[model samples]
Target chain A: MTKKIKETSNSETVVKTEEGKTLDQTVSALSSDAALFNREITQFNVEAETKKQRTATIVKNIFVYTFLTLCAIAAFLPFYWMIISSFKTEAEYRESIPTFFPRTFQWKNYSVVLSQTGAGASFGRILLNTLVVGLLSTTLGLIVIIITAYALARINFKGKNFLFALMLATMMIPGEMYTITNYITVSKWQWNDTFTILIVPFLVSVYYIYLLRNNFMQIPNSLYQAAKVDGLSDMGYLIKVMIPLTAPTLVSISLLKFIGTWNSYIWPRLVNIPDWRMISNWVTSGFTDSAGILGGSTSEALNTLKMAAVCMVSLPLFLLFIFCRKYIMHGVSKSGTKG
Target chain B: MPDKKDTLPQNDVNDVAGVEENVSNDAPQQPQAVKPSLAQKTKQAFADLGKKIKGVFVKDQVALIRDAGNTVITAEMLAGPQLSRKEKFSRFLHSQSGWLFVLPAVLLMCIFTFYPIINAFVGSFKQNYQATTGRFDGFGFENFVRVLKGDTGTGGATFLQCLVNTLVFTLVSVPLSTLIALLISVALNSIKPLQKAYQTVLFLPYLTNSLAMGAVFATFFTIIGTKSNPETPGLVNLALQAFGIAPIDWMGIGSPTWELGAISIPWAKYIVVIVYEVWSGLPFKILILFSALQSVNKQYYDAAKIDGASRSTILWKITAPMISPMISYLLITGIMGGMKQYSAIVGLFGEQMGIDYDMGTMVGYIYRYIEDGYTGYAFAGSLMLFAIIMVITAISNRISKKRVTY
Candidate 1:
């Protein structure tokens, strides 16, 4: 019987057909591999449709759509208000009767905020500072994360498990616990007003290391061995094989890191002077008509210019969201770690 | 042989004995078809016993010496109970690349993460600690006392008050937003035509700069006109005016308050905070819960339908429990994130957190102390915040266990 089974190639449950191996288990409406995503996810009331049941489903559908529409509006309202207010004049912004649409559009607010060359309020200089810090930190941090994750994933060494556990344990402690001491340490080194303070301290993020390690692990070890057999060194295998394979995860990490640096407020605010602080820091300073580009008391804080500043800060992230929604959402929902 | 001799006649003994010897010899070499006599079997057992006895009493040199013909394995090749220090070090170097790979991360973490953790604990205990000078008066719990008592000399919002605000906000908003997210995700899951559109729109807030969003939200409810000289009371009040209710000072200094003993609740101001929290926090929870809802097996719904269960019954009894683990995960993380909330308050109410810093959260309190050069108090406050997170996490875990049915 065993010999006959082996000869027939029927010992395994999966049947080899012309198409491919036939599935052993029964496939439900969405249980098939291809259908999991493309098919609608609703597990509806699939009972035989009587007129009453049909009407019930229709009513339920209506309620669901209305609720969703209302939620979407609530979710989109702030963004709309921010954009519209950015175009409004300062006097119009504070109008007791707010205008949904700007009475007169203005590109003047953006130009006014951009022209300020004051100490902390220098828009061009701060943007340059943010870009420099975001780039350097992301690149340096990526290298550190990659190497650490690769070693943890593929390399066999003494104390590897212990080292990983220790790293993960740090995540349990809130960052605020140790950040106060870091302030003293940085200040003691007199690293204030420099980019080193911003880039170096936050370079080693344990969460990213853990995430990349998991991603690296998903690429099978046989590939690593195959690379080695092909006369590739370990570093070469990592660069040519592991890195390419985990490109999606790397893109997600890089994007998040950049967004993190862009939106970072606390560390940059604490350790560096405002002149060297990040983009979010620049936005927090009340954007007034200090230039008097709009008709107002020059020193008075204007919501229009503030909105314009916020618009400028938020645009890049918005663009990133549109282009890379899949990668971003996957990264977020998988780990739920933001920066 | 002696038994045979006794049993057989003297004349026939030699021939019978020869035949018996041949049969025994044949039996020893042959298969189980030829059975062994008892005497022959006894002799073979004695031989094996001798070998076993010899093995116990004396050193078996054969174990040390490997077999030359077949695969060679010796006892000496095995690891002993103890390893030499030199051997350990050499083995460490054998995996040198692995060590080198993690070296940068371990070094930076040692410097910035691990060392600072130790220093915060030390600094928190030191009395009259000065940051610039790196000096301390002595070691005591005075910093903890002053921090808890609101006597750190820099005053606006006390640590206790901040703790209360954080708890109320977290307890109220996290669950409220979670329920709202659950409802939205369920609704989103059951839709077909506008699924992608609704999903894209709802997820727009996920990438928002909270600071910018906060300013926009602040405009929505911020009565632009002064209380004395009344004008249009923002969009929210405008809607309320349609219902014939008067506008209130929601975010201004003149905002109404009801003092419950030491702790005060600014209901109107809180409404703004809670509203923003729900709005800003919805996308992430929806993303998480929606994905979870998608993967829930249709079998459960089918089973519930066969049982004649109502829609709400299936939701509460079947669907909710199916994703209870994800819900609990969301809860723990949401509460923890809420405790560390500083920037959202800063965005809504400026760096001072509110007018006179009345809206300070726990992290805001810690940063305030840190900014004021009261490093000791900052350390103590941060430690307290850490402890609170640990305790709350434990409680949430306990609550989570009750929800995890299977």
Candidate 2:
């Protein structure tokens, strides 16, 4: 290493001394000689680096791939177990060395959940209700929040600071603080056992508004100004320019809102009566199993059925995640970047 | 209750239906042309002046006065219109657009949210039961007093412990989960093709309803089988058995503390609650960190590489500093989120779990007391929890904001 360093230093000094004679003759002579030496050194370095990088890259790849695969498996294990267990017979589940994979798939669990025995809560109706509530709430929430966020972000107004601060302050207060009063208001309005109870009460989200406002604020002022010069109305600018530009953030927030409304358990639980049930009622409120579909209380079939029910509820969202992983990741990352 | 009755829209169903009473009778004869005379107008103005004078002096004159000469006015404009340029602008601003673009949001918010919040604040004061009953007695500071003392008397469990428990859990778990998420996000950020797949997989738990997650945890954690030749067969117990150790009787009726034949599961509820919480929360942090990581310019990494910096050095010296703002944001929000955790506990341990509900979480205890008809105590507990969260969050914000390198 010392010898190599000394040689390189000597060559550097020689090159520096030669720099004063930098006209064509010195360059021509040196170019011919230097090209050969440069090729030799470049080849040597490339060969060495290739060998080293290939080996290290292989090892690194192996390690990263294995670690990442393990994490992915760990993430999916519980869900996979839940799905697999859902199809197992009651006897297979209870055994000391319970089979990890079911010998025979019990397809009836899905049917059992779906069929309205007209006795207890039907999983089908619950699913339909979930869809209704999710879509409705998301739609309403998106409308209110998008307009409000745009107004706050683009429209310079009086009390803007106070309003913005108030919205942020709302986020600090626990949601439960509103629970009793919301319940009272709903009951007073005779909205219990109805879909409006779920949708209207949660019509706006302060966090989403805050996030979208931040996103909207990042759009260039020139875009809006140009739109205005073209005689586009405020609504037109929002629809034509702002919406398209903020689509990624909008999609991300909408996804969050949809998921939140879908996954909401407590308010629905408190207000929803028997007939007016949602899918959450199946897994949470009533377990959605009547008769012997779940194979008596202590049966392995029961655990399996519960797992199946969970899978049924979670599968759609999970599948959506799998397919649109890129979109979701892109959307999520962009949303946070602006923050 | 009487006010509630008054507010409820009454249906005048049959009394007016097809009853052909002349509408003009109720309208009354048009009063013959008696416009306000100047004398009457002067008398009225004098009376208004008198009322204004009284409003300045009388204690109960709030209704008589509109502004009390305290409207939002610019003080610099009081130079009898001989003001400077700045004062004119200031005065112009005072009267212009007080609630212009913000009016719609504030109005909707007031009707939809603020109204309900006011109701909650008012409800926090009085102790009432049976929804329609008007018979509530004000307890002054008694509710707050009881909350502080951890006294429920005839109500239920002490709420003070729950408040402490919530604070402790939030304090511990927020940082813990955030750190875990940060580590995972950083690791995952370096990968190429499988990055999207990994994020989706990890985020699965957060997508599911917390109630379902809690139920699954509760069922799995509950003790299984009978005492003699007892089979402790949950996942944890099975793992213990595989290790040739005795199985823990989780969720047994006895205290899992220092007593013989006792089930001795230390902070079982908190663990269960935290596990479900962390499982559901990791995705949120991962998304946050991943986005922050993406914002960092690749040029920085290239520069560090040119300087012969290692990966770990680059992470510490380059990535961390760049992402400190996001990290701080996460810390503040994470604390706030954890402090308000209610649905997870309620989902798992509410009446359905067949275990004594954990009244140890602030919201859990408040929820329990409310269900048991202790409104006053629940509100007081909620108020205390709110105060604690606010103080902690404020401190966290101050510290994190100050320390944030960005």
Candidate 3:
């Protein structure tokens, strides 16, 4: 079954390229009287077949659309619930029968969350901390990755292939394996609860390096050779030629890395206490802390506040995904297929 | 092409001549190039110190000294004369100076990833490792033995239970999610319009923060009202109740009745995790398979139509095998990712899993050890996980080699 699929898919590409060459032959043969008569008969058969196929298609479409619409709702409902629940007041949220929509919009909940402080930092402060961590880590990581990828891709060096293979092998190891020792190392270095602890350890991502390296490899090596022949230094060539050539990929890597840092929870939870927690850490920890000035210390009150915080935290990422949907999808698809 | 290459070679020759002339012109300003600089002297001192430290471990001082001498000889050749084999070798090394570009990243990886991995392996053998003094009482296989025996000498579920949880989670979720994603992708591909809108909506879960969304999921499954009345059930329960089914405590904290072997399988928690995993994992898998399906030739379907093949036959025979590689890719990655599950569960059920480590995964189990200062056992657990991942990856790789085609 699989082999047949491969052949059919492969033959499709072949047919496209062969179509132009075979067009004249088919047209000329169709012009003959006997061929025309045979073609007319086949055309009638084709019309009938197409009509039958059309009904089948309509039936299929109905089923497909119904299934897809149901799945889409299942996908979208949670997010819709989150947004709507964020606007629900504590009393409404705690009602015996849950309301699909808020009885009355509670704009004050957002302001209350913003005003509340936990882990020695306000919500806005945690957001800023997250932004700073994301920006710094991504920027530093890109700089390191770009240079490494350029060297691996374009430059001839001793043991370059071996180094690349070694890096690829590291990717196979579960990242949890490194967490224990890294925590110890960071603690030994007295880097706990600091941005340095968050940003530094994760600055070198072999996956991003591999992705950018593949992109750099796609650029013609002749360009590097030409630049060298023109007396351009290696660094000069990398910055002038390669970087600009792979800007879209670099942007994709940066944006994805930024989102990764923003969404990071476990590492921040491990190393940073409440004082230095990122926005994600705050969303999980801050709402449950009784010291926060948001509302009364009840599960019902906290649920509303928690939903509001979740909506606030997720809003920026949602907007970013909406705006840069193409790049994000392209990056993921490129990595998935290439791997 | 010949004429263009000929002109280009001439230009290259002129450029080389220009470079040579410039080097010769600048040669007078650097007359003492053969002499080592202060930086070179410091670097050599550091290398000598490194050799001394390494001698304690390596016992091959002669080879180390010989390598050091060879480096000095190469440096001298680069600075002094350009007529011998040494000079040629030195030029080769100079041309391969791109190592300098990758040096920073390599150094960071060595310290943060490679060194820690080795340290973890070493530390796993150490008993009662003292973090403050950076010492251990002794080294043995005791930690690994304890981990395997599910006897951490602590009052909790054994490491075996955690391993089972992880394996069961991965085993169930990976294939289920991949199958759903494949079906969804196929259905989405068959449609003509609103495909993008459907894709955008379906991909929403992927963009969500797992921890936050997990909290939202916890809310979705929260059953309100007393046990008898069950008046205000969560959304999921409400939907189930519409069909006359009773509400379930989805996090499994309230009451778990299902049992598998010695452990009670918290079906509610398992279901919630699997649902979340499938929903979140769908976007990437669907994206991959959909693209693969779209790229399949329409002529195949037409051919099948002429042969009077049913839609199911066409889909199964012609579509599934074509996207087998993508399916395999998602499966392997999904399993690997599922085994490493941690924060999402924590987000759903908090730090303690189901009344005290009942739902603890392998990673969560390791984390609990870490929190309790059982660093040795934690490292041991990590090594076991590493081994499992390697074996699974190898087996899957071999299977894919035979099963998946370009």
Candidate 4:
């Protein structure tokens, strides 16, 4: 099956090359001596203009580089401020005029935030909760997404198009509309303050399913046919052929889902308070509560400690992004292009 | 050769029928065959069921391939014997396999998403929804009226204020961010050196925790000096001071505002929120537009160059039109996202907006009611938000259809 698809494509390319050669030959045959001489003169003119264009290009590039550098600094300076502020002593942080660099690095702020407990949950516990929720939701969501996408893309079943269209329609509605009822539903189920509330409501993502479906559809149907001829079952074809082929897309989806789960604020904050709060909740509420004890009644100390907490929560994701930058960027760009 | 192979399954079907008839005919004559053991009978029944299921699936497989418009079906298989009861059941299962795969997701969506959406719509009309008793006193437009009238008894900005704040935020930030992103993307696309570095740096903000980043931004706006002391302003104020301007209180009681009757627009908070929105929102738009700019045909640029077109003309005419669809897409989605702004504000302003929900957005207003146990009002606010979103989406869809250049 694969061979047949390849052969047809190859043949088309061969036909295109043949047509291009003929066109080139006709263009060359039409040229006369006078035309050739005129072309030479034009080529000389182009060669002369190239030197002038080169200088303009250099000047343009310099301007582009300078502008981009400034923008990049603007984009990155806040993060730099966050990091430097995290390391500043309370007195240094509050010195009427803020210092760009810390006079004395107070690494104790990190230890303070990590050890401090807010509303019966420590910062460490909150971080653990975030990791657990992010991992569990992303893993479970991926399983459902892969199967649904495979069935939609590969199987010939009734009402498949209608089901897909319905799912897509749901994406058009802003998520804020559902939060009120979702909170009510979760509360009624007695699932609030539990990990189940965090994981269950968001387990089925229509966008991820659509993305994986597109990836699945790109797999040649011939592969499925050949797998069938080899006595492979439907599940076997999906696991062995489709999943392995779309590993990059699956990885992209998983990373994106995990990042989303890690960055989630509103739903988790609504359903799970104080005890079950994620790291973000801790960043917001925990720092403010501990400001008196940690900062010693100085606003500067409180601000410094808060920056430390921010840096701690942001570091893991920042590192993840830096390391797996390609996958994240590729996934984002692929979604944009496909849309 | 393919035709000969296609007939083989038909021949096998006939052979199986003949064997079945012979077995049934011999069953009565042979006492042992007729009076088989219970286990033997069960095994025979299972075999027959399996054969029937296989036959149905095989027929479906043939039909599916034929539907691909690649193969020709022989007349014999096309007009074969009517489906038996077992075959019909198997065919039903085969057709429903797609649902089997999608059932988990669909069930979850129905329970968590679809049901809740419907419930929210219904609950919006209820005057007082009791969470404990799981009931409402009666259905009326009281919830909607109270919410719209800003009479939630919270003494905050009316629902109208929240709606106006949300609309203004969306209207101002979406276009501003899109324009900045377009300019940045065009510049980034033009440069050849360190392009990846610039992109990665710009995208870092998109990945940061909003609340934490909001903290950083809050500090950015923090002024160290009071009116009496008149010293040590925040980074933003310091920057303003460089231009010989007075220090502005960005997020405090003295923050700047423009009042017209009951409605007051806090310029300081608006500036802060818009800046945050533009910063956080720029990466995705830049990503989209940059790729679109990259894919703009080089031949067009060459033609424009040959015609001695100015840089601005080439960009507006040749490049802009090519990526107009992406711009339209970003605009619509950006507006939708902006209208749902809640977390970023919470991160910046804390829970109450101001002392009494002064800075509350539509989502934030609904949330405040939810926190106050006014489920009906929350649901009503949600419905209003949904309606506004739908109207905007419809308008955007119409605009895109007319303006987007495919």
Q: Which candidate comes out best when scored by DockQ?
A: 1
Top of the candidates by lDDT: 1
lDDT of 4 by residue, B234-343 (tens): 78887887899888888888888999776789988888888888888888898889988999889999999999998889888878888999999999988887888887
Give the poorly placed runs of model 1, Cα more than 4 Å off: A1-49, B1-92
TM-score, cand. 2 vs. native: 0.71
lDDT of 4 by residue, A191-222 (tens): 75568888988999898899899999999888
Chain A only: TM-score of every candidate? 0.82, 0.75, 0.80, 0.79
Q: What docking grade does candidate 2 earn?
A: incorrect
> What does candidate 1's lDDT look like per residue over B310-389, in tens digits?
98898899878888898899988999888888788888888888876789899988888888888899999989988999
All DockQ scores: 0.47, 0.22, 0.43, 0.41
Poorest 10 consecutive residues of model 1 chain B by lDDT? Answer: B51-60
What is candidate 4's CAPRI-style docking category based on DockQ? Answer: acceptable
The reply for model 2, stretches above 4 Å from the true place, is: A1-67, A116-120, A153-161, A214-245, A286-290, A293-301, A323-339, B1-108, B127-131, B153-157, B189-200, B219-223, B227-232, B252-265, B294-322, B350-354
Better of 2 and 4 by lDDT: 4
Clashing pairs in 1: none
TM-scores computed on chain B for all candidates: 0.79, 0.66, 0.76, 0.80
Error of 1 at A335 (Å): 2.7
Clashing pairs in 4: none
**What are the clashing pairs of model 2?**
A90-A301, A126-A279, B256-B263, B256-B264
